[model samples]
Target: MKRILLTGCAGFIGSNFVKTIASEQTDYEFDIIDALTYAGRKETIQEELNKHSFLQFHHLDIRDSSKIEKLFQERKYEGVIHFAAESHVDNSIKNPNIFVETNVLGTLNLLNASLKLFKENEAFRFVHVSTDEVYGQLTDDEPAFTEENQIKPSSPYSASKASSDLLVQSYYETFGLPTMITRCSNNYGPYQFPEKLIPVMIFKAQAKEKLPVYGDGKNIRDWIYVDDHNKGVWDVFLKGLAGEVYNLGGDSERRNIEVVNIILEHLGRSKELISYVTDRPGHDWRYAMDFSKARKELGWSPTVKFEEGIKKTIDWYLENKTWIEMVKGNNK
Candidate 1:
């Protein structure tokens, strides 16, 4: 059985990926290491915990070098899908040092551990999950960011993520450590933290509170459904060549206002609640991914339509109000 170590297994994306992997692969041994940050909750992994015999949990922080070293010393993970990091842009803006510590240095800690572990096993691969925000903003006519786009991170969050990407590349160059990266666009689905745009808007709209729109809400982002993003990760992890970077996107480009309006429409809510707020500092104007390389090389594309996905997302938020409340810190 292939042993897989997945970091940040309690976060929105990581937990979803774990559920998908556990359900699909019943024979593989999966070890999850998570710090259980504010955004990561044990409730997110409940279904997988109850259902999968091959799944095991460890409450370990990636920044703790001894803990990470011990984890590598004990298990021979055939592959690693690293998803752990401080991911909120607002939070990063408030405190940039934590972002640097966790994102840049923490990533290096994992990479170093992987380097030591790989000495015993030569064929393992490390898949580093990243975001498209690392490319900063785009002009109206500029082509979508392909692998060749220059890195121009604007925020502490994107800067930190970009820093980690550089470290991942350095490992590949200096030690020839097998590593691959996937820079995915914004992801939304079940179990998302309420701080994000989609879930926050859903909550505020449901309560008739202000649906805050940063700036004019014209900023564009390529939003991919979380399940589709998971499939993209698995595809690149299993089939992608080492030291390569793949950009994963849903090809669903929607402006901020358009996305909010769609959410309101799905919830049977009004647009009167829409409120314009101050734009974030160094906020990227737009982010679009060029996934042709991924399509041609990995033979992968998103299966969900944007409208259908949005409807499903709205329905999920409605049906899983209990989960939403828990994530909001109101249930506890």
Candidate 2:
């Protein structure tokens, strides 16, 4: 049985990944470590807790180097799938130091522990989950960011993630650690924190409040379903070559205004609800990924279309009002 340690297992993407693996791999053992930070919630995994024997959860911060070291010493984890970080761009803008500390130092702590533990086992792989924002904005004329794109992160959050990616690469180059990195586009689906674009818009519309659209809402983002993004990460984790980077996108590019309009239409809300506000500092104009590598090598393709996925996501949030309420309560 493969014993895998998944960090940030309570956040949106991480939790989705855990659920997917739990359903698919009955014999696989998973040990989840999450700090239950403002973004991490136990309720994310509560549904499968009673049902999955192969899964275990631990409430711990990745920054606790000693605890991380101890866990590594005790557990025989075959692989480490890292997802923990301060991920929100707005929050990162408000407090960049936390982003640097968590995204860079936290990742380093995990890398250090993994390297030390896997010294005797060179075949162990480390999958670092990252974002396409590291590539910064793409010009209207420029094509999507491929794996070969140079790093040019603009926001503090993206910079921190880029820093972590560099550390991952250093581990691979300096120590020959088996590592793979996946940079994926914006993900939207169930259990997402309301601070994010899709959920925030949905909630504001439901409350009959102004849906804040940053700037003119012309910024473009390739929207990939959370589950599809998770599958792309797993594809890179299991079959990808060490020291390589892969880009994963749903190939569905939508302007921010377009997304807001779609949500409004789906919920039977009016476009007048959209309030165009000042854009955040250093907001990227666009982010699109060229995911041909993952598709060709791992045979992974996004199955859900943008319209269908967004509607399903809206329905989920509507049905699971308790979860949304609980998450909102935590921010207080």
Output the worst ten-in-a-row residue range by lDDT, candidate 2: 19-28
What's the lDDT for candidate 2?
A: 0.90
lDDT of 1: 0.90
lDDT of 2 at 330: 58
Q: lDDT per residue, candidate 2, 110-152, as tens digits?
A: 8998898679677689999999999999877789999999999
Query: What digit string (tens of lDDT, one per residue) describes model 1 on residues 29-114?
Result: 88998888888897889788888878888988888988888888888788899999999999999999999988998899899899
Clashing pairs in 1: none
- What are the Cα lDDT values of the candidates? 0.90, 0.90
Off by over 4 Å in 1: 330-332
